[model samples]
Target: MFLKFLTFTIAIGGSALGGPIDPFGSSAARVLTQLPEKTWLESIAVRRNGDILATSLFYSSNIFTVTQPSVHAHNTAKILASVPEVNSLLGITEVPGSYDEEAFFFVGGNFTSLTTFSTTVGSFKGFKLTFPRNGNPTVQKVSDLAPFSSFPNSVTAIPQAPGSVLVADSFVGAIGRLDLLTGQYDPRAFAFDDMAVPKGAKLPIGISAMRMKGSYLYYGNPSTQSIYKVKVDSKGYLVKGAQPSLVANISSVAPGLDDFIFDPQGNILLATNSPENAIVHVDVRTGRSKRIIGGPTDPLMPDSTCLAFGRGILDTNTFYVSTGRNISDPTTSARIVAVDASLLNYY
Candidate 1:
């Protein structure tokens, strides 16, 4: 039964723009694996062990893990558990805590909080799955952030504050904090509209994805199709110098960029549903951007949703892209792609 979900696909050799160029040396872009047509790969995180944990976009109900994929075979797929069927699950991130290793995922729709069982009232919520290094993994409700969010999307663990994570909501247009230990969230802390935003297509959903760099927490604003960064203190509080500022915009880069990952060099790359790029790199320092894949070079990577760097020394310099294009027929072309960053001048 499980084997049916596994798709042994082709070794894709293409790019996202211009002509076919080797983005990953020998393999520019290959279809590593495929998901169900109705489902979409949303957010991804590289585990300490080099594995990947991913969440679904639209209506995919399962959270799964994938080992490093290769041309020799497809991604080894395994569904850890099934979430609510309401298509609430959106953003996901891994928490590498000393006491416990786990993955936290968000779900927002009619649900009020993150619960393993059904409830009469529904809203914004999320789950916490603890995967013990030596024992079996367990998935449970982390918190219901309805009071703090209208539609929660992505979440990032606060390294300085144990059992605490920063969460952003699309519809509410605010950022809040989720206390993992108590399964609750503080009042919404920041608002996007308060900042000076540039003119562009606002993805109705507002802010979606986020990541941390030293003492700063960077998040993606789907509304303006731009990335922004703010400073936070050691305890995850917004410092006095912390002001929401634009990092870069996707107005000219792609139709719109979704979840992005940081290259080892501190530069950033984003995924898009537009034909302009499946993967585009942005120099955070200068705010200059370049397309690594997607314009006419590789049609195979339409609607690239999320991306993450390969963990560990074995897959260093390797970046993986997850695509779920053709929303009309999502599964037929949805795939996980790889780009070799081993040979690049990011600095």
Candidate 2:
């Protein structure tokens, strides 16, 4: 096996198993690139070749790719696509092709717009994205936001469903399914949750990140800072209007939870905002959590916001995290970085 990096940090939080993790590895973490001009690196999608197609709030109509190390910024990452008439690209999930050809898609919202402030009632649109192997990427509108959808935040592609995707509405508190093959839309595939207005924020904050497990759909929200799972049908689709039940309560571990992915062993690999730069490993069966990477515990890296498991053959155990203080002010340390997660996977 091979490895690369900056620094690796791990701290078990809940379970009392397997001695403390080591933080002595050579830095396998590599910063994708620097953030300049407030470009909010929003979401990431791993290409088959291991490159990442990243979207943003500021560069709404553009999707950039983080490629090989280069002597200049333009060479390292340049415009991969210039989507037409799109605003604020965020949630992105790759839709498997029906035949030999595959396609990817993204969700667009008005979150970064000034006119949509204070209200959680805005709608979004979904697009079918094509990243040509020999050329740049392209975008095509596949479905408009369903009436029940309000600010779609996360889009996850369902492998079982041929070209099907589920989009999470952050404020409306629901998950909708879009059939890319037929342009069919189910506005309410599953009932995600929304919390009573937190003491500080407006509106009932709802689901943040979503991913599919074996016959179940798992997601996280502000409600008690817990992650919930719901049953899905044989086709890996959730019943419309069905509610998800709680699986793990990790409030004590990572209070400000964000996006997450599944590890090889079926563990929950998630990011947190309160700790700001942490990746927590949660045991759903035992309801335990361990901060595997980042925190005040690590002086080198700060808290991260977004999380995506690497999709390339060589990088399955790797994960990409977006580390920044906030949306508006991406710090010097603010960067889209990659981490070799083999330690956490097998630890």
Candidate 3:
């Protein structure tokens, strides 16, 4: 059975400049494109070359990429290569190399393994990556990678620090970092500690999505319906025994936040919750939030399962978001939409 919830859509009946022109505010968002039929679209990453990469658990084990024109418009996506027949492929990243080239890499949790694609080989069963695109991307097994049997939920490449990657180990309530060169876990990297909740209170939940800003690491808690920010050291390591501060409380809106992404300006944060099947935005500086998209308010919109920040081809102020047909759906039929970031100004 599909769980129903409330959502606030951009009120179109109001005056353009007087009333709420858009729920999000900036006039930067609009529905740009919809994904192909599938079931569970999980996480997305973009390459410096402007290629969009995405992974789907409900679909086959593969990495998909889409190329768009200089303008922010919808374009068809093509499957670059199928991930090895591993248990489950969860996240992908574009690692840059010398002379402005990049190597595409992906990590999976169920199998507790990391794999890199080769242009020469159709598929490489291990973690080693070889450059100089000859044929299909080549892959080799690397040593010293962190192994978490409980399963990792998400993997992200920090744009500010190239070669430094982070993985959210959901079951362990921790985030781990992998060194690109040695393919080994960096013990000095930052992560949350003292995460255990008080006797009567619930523990700080596992992180579903994370973004780095200056010396702080911002993360979303899917289980607790909260967003937190923690201070980190110079090496991008979390300060030892550091306690996370609540940036925004979402328990009132939804009990579970599936994912979240930051807007271009970094002033706004958008999140999607499963129970409510809605998207909400918050002002990072003030911790104030408002319903900007999804919910029972719009009959045409489906339950939102996941979301990410995408720039529209035409407008720099425009940001795009993608939603899965159902968080529980076993296939990849999902929708991608654009919304004006300026709408946040109304709130």
The best candidate in terms of lDDT: 2
lDDT of each: 0.63, 0.64, 0.51
lDDT of 1 by residue, 160-238 (tens): 7766777877666678887777766674766657322334533355676778888788888755778889888887888
Q: How accurate is candidate 3 locally (lDDT)?
A: 0.51
User: Model 1 reaches what TM-score against the true structure?
Assistant: 0.81
Number of colliding residue pairs in each model: 17, 12, 45
Show where candidate 2 strays beyond 4 Å.
1-28, 68-75, 112-123, 132-136, 192-204, 239-243, 296-303, 324-334, 344-346
lDDT of 1: 0.63
Estimate, for each residue in 25-109, the C-alpha lDDT of model 3 and write its tens digit.
2243444445555534465655554445556553445445555522544454455544444434555555556663456555553
| Cα-lDDT of candidate 2 | 0.64
Pick by TM-score: 1 or 2, better one: 1
**Model 3 segments beyond 4 Å from truth?**
1-37, 69-74, 93-99, 111-145, 158-161, 186-205, 296-308, 311-315, 327-332, 343-347
lDDT over C-alpha atoms for residue 223 of model 2: 47
The candidate with the higher TM-score, 2 or 3, is: 2
TM-score to native of every candidate shown: 0.81, 0.78, 0.71
